[model samples]
Target: MKFVKDGASDIGMKLHPFTLRFVDDQAYLEEEYRSYYFSESISSIRITLVLAIFFYAVFAGLDVAVAKQYQTQLWLIRFAFVIPVLVLLLILSYRPWFRKNVQALVGIGMYLTGFGIILMIFYISKIGLYTYYAGLMLIFLIGYTFIRLRIVSATIAGWSIVLTYEIVALCFAHTPTIALINNNFFFVSANVIGMLICYFLDRTNRRDFFMRKLLEVERNKVKAANDVLEQKVQERTQQLLETNVELKKEIELRKQYEQERTKLEAQLMQLQKMETIGTLAGGIAHDFNNILTPILGYTEMALEEVEEDNTLRFDIEQINHAAVRAKDLVQ
Candidate 1:
């Protein structure tokens, strides 16, 4: 339902006169629309019932008063006709299934109520009680105020009542010429005014329905957007969580590599230290071997110079043994 751009008001937008029509492009006769109308009618049941009962009582009392002064039989007939229609309205009001046909029911009820009133008016005129003709206004008032109906239904019902009354009064009631003219004028004026009011009432209701549908559409759109946004947020959150897990694993792997590198560096340093010690020991062993070689050469020379059985030769032999032991140690 597209709203015309106009000044904003309590109803959300200005309701142009062109918008007032019996046919609504935005759902008016659809199921949801009918349901809305049905609910509204159901809600008004109590009020309509009370009004019916109150009017029935008033008219019954009037019937009694007029009957005492006029024909009792005709008043009885009017009472019987009106009382049954009111009872039917009350019964139908409480029937949950009857709401679907609410417009038809109300139209029928209104027509019957008008018919009863017309009958009473006929009797009143027959008894020369012209003053009671003013009561016809009650029918129009009741149609407008108590019963909620579509413009077409109301118009049909309203005109039917007037037409029936005119025909019955003109044909059967034998109303005088001046009185007939007056009744015609009154009924016509009342129906026209009632129809106008019914038209606007229906238009206003349709506009309100249009606004509600528009709001529902907007709300659904917003909900869909929010759902999409929430889904995206969840997906992004999941992706970030997965990325965080990967980063943690990478950090742990890097830490493991660093530990392995540190251990390797410590082992490499120990290997390097062992290599340096081996080189130093080899240099010291070469120096010691050179010293032992000199000692052994001196001892051998001493042995050659001295005799085999001499004391000096024995001392040279002990020194040669010591030199040989030192050479073995150097090797």
Candidate 2:
């Protein structure tokens, strides 16, 4: 109902000390993100399939046009492009994770393989051309780059570029279909170059991903370890405080015991002194009583012998009084 701010607060503003928000775990957030990505990926795949179908129809129409106008044998090449692209789209749309990771690689690899096969067919048909196919390969290369599939994506792009260049050179060379084997140099060179570039890029990306994941794991581990260490320290500190409190109490008790011991010692010494005094007082009183009895008897006999007018009588009374004083001192 009420709040107090530790620092300066505006007139209408209130700060509640206990108000706090607990964030979700990192793993949970990651899982949620992955799920979102998977869902979006499914939609993208469906869109890709629709686009592929439209493009396949267009390629079919183009094949018919070329065949009607030029009597070219692009049918096999055109149909080849259509069938593979269709298969790839359907596979991606229906089974995103089908073949696990390798299948996806193969699916992407199929694009280049299909392009190469179409080129081979064109060369075989004596209607080999670069102007028509090169643009399509470039477009596919750029699209594959955007997919961000690391090695597979880079492989697709690199191969697309190299193969398109080779196809162009092959057209310029005007090599016979029978002599295609003699152009193996270009084929081998393109494959090797593309593979090397993709390999390098893939390695770099892999290292980046690995380092990021490692840092995240280490950060979480350190935080967990620190929390455990803090709890242990708190427990140990509390235990030490309790132990110190007990020690202080023990010290106080010991001090009290020592004080009581000292008091008892002093009391014992006092009692010993009193006991010695009592013994000395009793012995002196017995001797003084004996002395007084004789002195008193002598003094009384002298008083009777002297008569009422004798001068010695006063002296005898004085002696008797002096003896009485000595007896009182003894008592």
lDDT at 51 for candidate 2?
A: 60
lDDT of 1 by residue, 155-183 (tens): 78888988887787789888888988987
Q: What is the TM-score of each candidate against the true structure?
A: 0.75, 0.42
User: Which pairs of residues have clashing backbones in candidate 1?
Assistant: none
Please tell me which predicted candidate would have the highest TM-score against the true structure: 1
Q: What is the lDDT of candidate 1?
A: 0.74
Assess each prediction's global lDDT (C-alpha) against the native. 0.74, 0.54
Instruction: List the lowest-lDDT window of 10 residues for candidate 2.
Output: 13-22
TM-score between model 1 and native: 0.75
